[model samples]
Target: MMLAILIICSQITIPLPGVPLTLQTFAIGMIATMLPLRDCLLIIFTYLLIGSVGLPVFANFAGGLPILLSPLGGYLIGFLIYGLITSGILGLTSRSSLTICLANFLGAASQLIIGGLWLIPANHLTLSQAMTIGVIPFIIPGILKLFLVVIVAQRLLKARLLAR
Candidate 1:
């Protein structure tokens, strides 16, 4: 549900070679920390399925197998890893603000890895070149996203705790 909503709100465009500022990453991290690992993966996969079927589920209102086959496809696949890593890390932590932040950062790193892998072959880039084109440009934004998602997750968890 959240992924669908985010997809509609967001659009896909590779400002760089492999990195797009879609809400997919943000949504993945948020869902990972909030939902169970299985559910998070389901949501990630569902989003892709929607996109693959030409639902415009990608960023910039782009979708279809063409997008998936594109360099950004790696990042799309990375969303699954992002969700799994974030959810798993949060599951092991004490549900504290600090740990949630750590989880988000780790999730972001995982997404970067996926993005880099996608860029290398798709863009004909080396590791260092891929990092420059696929990873470096997005670092600041990704960090900001991690901080924001952590803050929101912490607040939500805190509120739930208070409610209990």
Candidate 2:
């Protein structure tokens, strides 16, 4: 189910020059928030592995080693970092609203930063150019996505409590 969500999220994209905007980070944050660190890692890695094996699972239904090694690939790597940090935080500490928001924000920021940095060399872009195209464009949207992830995570937790 989570894997399906990830794939679906990837398909929803707004094209940009360097990196297209997608809800992948939002889905990843939710997965990390809902699952243990290891499980979250497994899910993220599985998604990447499937994409690496030439599945049309990435944004715009495109996936291959070329996509993984493309300029936008750092965001994919950031997804792994995102799962680790976000899931590790939720696992190591209390699962409160504050923690959830903080962890998700950190994960999102890390992803954007890594992706922006990757653009510098991969696309022969300067730091300013990378920030302009890669990082700055996503800041506001990332925040919105972070809030959405938090809300969904809280609701899921509440539903689970109610179920129990």
Candidate 3:
């Protein structure tokens, strides 16, 4: 069910220059908060594997190895990294809103860093140019997503709709 939600979220794309804006990070945040660390990693890895095998599970319904080889590929891999970090944080910390918010922020930062680094070599861009396109535009939206994730996860936990 969570994997399906992620796939749907991944399809909700606003195409940008190289990386398309999607609800993936938001869904990832929620998944990391709600599921156990091993389960969260499994879901993320499964999503990546499905997309890598050409199942149209990526942004704009893109799939296959080519999608994984594209400039935006690192962001896809970043999802796994983000899930790992967020899940680890959730495991170690209390499930307060602040904790979730911090975890999501850190996860977003990791994604931005990895994606920016990959963009530099893949797109033949300078660090400034990569940051300009890959990281800058996403920061605000990422924060907004973090806020939403924190609120929603808190509510879900309070309502007993989601596991801690």
Candidate 4:
């Protein structure tokens, strides 16, 4: 179910250079908020594995090692790390709004940071160029998604859908 959700989210893309903006962050947040770290990692790994094997599970219906190694590759790789950090934080600490907010922020930052760094090498871009396209543009959207995830996750947790 989560795997399907990730794939579905990937298709809700607004095409952009380097990487398309998608609802992938939304799905990633949901997965991070709702699942245990171990389970979350397993799910993210499976999602990446499928995409890497050319299942068209990535954003813009893209898949394969080429895509995995492209300028957008860091974000793809960052997803797993994002899952690890966010889910691990939630697993080990209180699930208060504040805690969730911090975890999400840190995890999201990790994605942008890693992705930005990857762009420098992959695209042979200067740091400023990578920051311009990779990190700066996504900050506000990432914050919005963070709040949405916190609200939805709390509600879902209260509803006991898989139980936190």
Cα lDDT tens digits, model 3, 34-114, are: 888999999999998989998998888889988888898888889888988888999999999889888888987998789
**How far off is residue 148 in model 1, in Å?**
0.2
Stretches of candidate 2 exceeding 4 Å from the true structure: none
Best by lDDT: 2
Assess each prediction's global lDDT (C-alpha) against the native: 0.79, 0.91, 0.89, 0.89
Model 1, residue 31: distance off in Å is 0.6
What clash pairs does model 3 have?
none
Candidate number of the best TM-score: 2
Please estimate how well model 4 matches the true structure, expressed as its whole-model Cα lDDT. 0.89
Per-model TM-score, in order, reads 0.90, 0.98, 0.95, 0.95
What is candidate 4's CA lDDT for residue 87? 94
- In candidate 1 the C-alpha lDDT for residue 35 amounts to 84
**How many residue pairs clash in each candidate at the backbone level?**
4, 0, 0, 0
TM-score computed on alpha carbons, candidate 1: 0.90
TM-score of 3: 0.95
- Assess the local accuracy of residue 103 in candidate 2 as a C-alpha lDDT between 0 and 100: 96
Candidate 2 TM-score versus the reference:
0.98
Two-way lDDT contest, 2 vs 4, winner? 2
**Superposed Cα deviation of residue 57, candidate 3 (Å):** 0.5
How far does residue 74 in candidate 4 sit from its true spot (Å)? Answer: 0.3
lDDT string, candidate 4, 1-164, tens digits? 98899899999998887778898988898899889999888988998898899999998888998988999899989998889899999999988889888888888899888999899999999999999989999898888988999998888887885664
